[model samples]
Target chain A: MKRALTKRIVIDGVLTAMALAIWVVEAQIPLPLPVPGIKLGLANVVTLFAMFALGPLDAGVILLVRIGLGSVFGGGLTAFLFSLAGGALCYLLCLLLRLVVKDKQIWVLGALGAIAHNAAQIGVAIALTRTTGLVVYLPVLVAAGVITGTLTGLAAQASYLALKRTTLLSRLKGGASLPKEPDDVAGEEDETEKKNQK
Target chain B: MKTWVWVVIVAVILAVSLTVGVVLLTRQPQGNVAYVYVDGELVYQVDLSKVDQPYLYTVNTPYGTNVLEIAKDSIRIADADCPHKECVEQGRLKGSPLVCLPHRLVVKIAEDDADSVSR
Candidate 1:
C-alpha cells in the first residue's frame, strides 16, 4: 500500500513538471492574436492525459501544482487568480465529462474544458476590471477557444492512445491506488477491445 | 453518444462563434471619444477626433503603469509594464476595447451621448 502511494506521488510530480514546462514554453511563443487570455493552452494536454490515464483526483493535483508554479515563474498575483478561476472550472467540467466521454473522445473534454476555462477567465477579467465593454471579446475568445481546444484535445487523445500501447499505462493505473468507481470503469474494457480490434 | 455526434456539436459551436466574432471584430466603433478607467473609476476621457498632435497618456495604477498613445482619430497602448504586454499588442483601438487585465485598466471608445448620460 505504501509503495503504491509513493508511485502515485512520483507520477503526479512528473506530470506536474511536464505541465509546468509546457506552460513556460508556451508563454514564450508570442501568439499572433493581440487579444489577452488567448493561447494554444498546450499544457492542458498533459492534464487531459493524466485525467484519463490516472483519474480526476490525480489530474486535479497535477493541474493545481502546475498553475501555482506556473504563475510564480511567469505571471504574478493577478495571473494566479485568473488561472485559479479558469483551472477550477476546467477541472470540474472534465470531471463531469469523464463519465460519458469515451477514451477515444478525450478531445471532447479538451474542447469543452477549454471553452469553460476561457469563459471563466473572461468572467474574472470582467469582475476585476469592472468593465462591461470587455464583453466584446467574448465571441472572439469562444471561437479561439474552440479551435485551440480541439487541437489540444486531439493531441491529448493521440498521446493517450500511444501510451496505451505500452505497459506504462497499466503501471500508472496501478500506481493511482484508488479503485475507480464501477460506473466510471464501465465501458472502458469494451473501448479497449474495440481499439485492439482496430 | 457516438463520436460523430460530439464532432457535429463542436462544429456547430465553432461555426456560430466564428461568425459572431467576425462580425464583432469588423464592426466600427460608435464614436471617437475614448474613456480611460482605472480600477473601475473613470479617470480620463479623450476625444480622438480633436487630438491635433499625438501624445502619450500614462496611467499609473496600483497594479502597474500603462502608457497610451493618443493620435489623430485613434488610440492604442504604446507601452505597459504588465507581464504579457497583450494590451500593447492590441494595437489601435477599433471595435473592441483595449484591456490591460493585469493593471485593471480599460480604454474604450464610447459614444459622446453615452458618456454624458453616464456622467
Candidate 2:
C-alpha cells in the first residue's frame, strides 16, 4: 500500500513539474493585452487538474509550489508578488467554484476565477502605482479572462477524462493507504461515471 | 495528440495577438495627457476639452524628454530618448493609460470626472 502511494506521489510530482515548466516557458511570450493585468492563463490547466485529482488541500500545495517555482523561474521577487496575488486569488475561487459547479460548467468557474485573479492583481497594481486611472481596462481584462479560462477548462477536462480512465487514476483517487476497491477493474469501473456510461 | 501542442498553440495565438495589439495600440488616436499641476505641485488633473488651445507638458524621465500635448484628448513625446518609445507613441491617455517603460511613468485617464465604466 505504501509503495503504491509512493508511486502515486511521484507521478503527481512529475505532472506538477511539467506544469511549472509550462508556466516558465509561457512567461517568455509577451502579453497581448497591454491594459495591465491580462494574460493567457496558460498554467491554470494544471491547477484544475490537481484540484480534481488531489482535492483542494493537495491542489493548494500544487498551486503554491507551482507559483513559487514558476515565479522564480519566470519573474523576479516583485514580479512574483503580482502574479502570485493573481494566481492565489484564482486558486481560491476555483476551489469554491468546484463544489457548486461540475462537468462542463467548470468552464464558467475557470472564467470567473481568471477574472477574479486579474481584478485582484489590478487592485495591487493600482495601489503600487499610486494611480487609480487604469480602472478603465477592467472590462477588457474580464473579457480576456472569460476567453482564456474557458479554453483552459476545456483542456483540463479533456486531460482529466483521459487520466481518470487509467488504472492509476482509481488508485490515486483511493488516497494513500485508503481502502482499495475489489473486483471493480474487470467490470468497467463503477456506475458513478456520468459521461462514460453514455 | 500531445499536451505540448496545446501549449504551443496557445503560445502562437498569444504571439499573433500581441503583434496585432502593438499595431492597434499604435493606431489609437494620440489624445492629451494631463499631469495636473496644482500650486506648483505635480498633480493629476489635465483636461482636454476644458483647455482652449494645444498645451504641451514636458516631463523628464530616464528616457529623456517626454512631451505630452493636450488637444481634444492627449498625446505624448514625438521624439524620445528611449529605444521603445511605446509610451510616447501611446499618444493621449484620456480614456486609457500611457505607459512609458523607459521612465517608469504611466499616464492614465482619470475616471473621477469621466463618464465611462467604473474601476
Top-lDDT structure, candidate number: 1
The DockQ assigned to candidate 2 is: 0.10
Across A1-198, the per-residue lDDT of candidate 2 in tens digits comes to: 676666556646755686787677766665644565455777777777768866777677777888888766745553577678888899888877787665545555566777778777776666555556555555556657767876777777766676676764666666454435444532333232223212
TM-score value, chain A, candidate 2:
0.81
In model 2, how large is the Cα lDDT of residue B63? 30
Predicted complexes: DockQ each? 0.70, 0.10
User: Poorest 10 consecutive residues of model 2 chain A by lDDT?
Assistant: A189-198
lDDT tens readout by residue for model 1, B1-119: 99999999999998998899888887898988999998789999998899999999999989899999999999999999998898998899898888899999998888767434643
- Estimate candidate 1's alpha-carbon lDDT, on a 0 to 1 scale: 0.83
Put down candidate 1 lDDT per residue, A74-128, tens digits, no spaces. Answer: 7888888888888899999999998999988999988889888888888889999
lDDT of 2 by residue, B42-100 (tens): 54557665777776666675335566666665445455555345455454453466654
Model 2 has fnat of 0.07
**Model 2: residues with Cα > 4 Å off, grouped in runs:** A1-5, A175-198, B1-33, B36-94, B100-104, B109-119
Which candidate wins on TM-score? 1
The chain B TM-scores of all candidates, as shown, are 0.92, 0.54
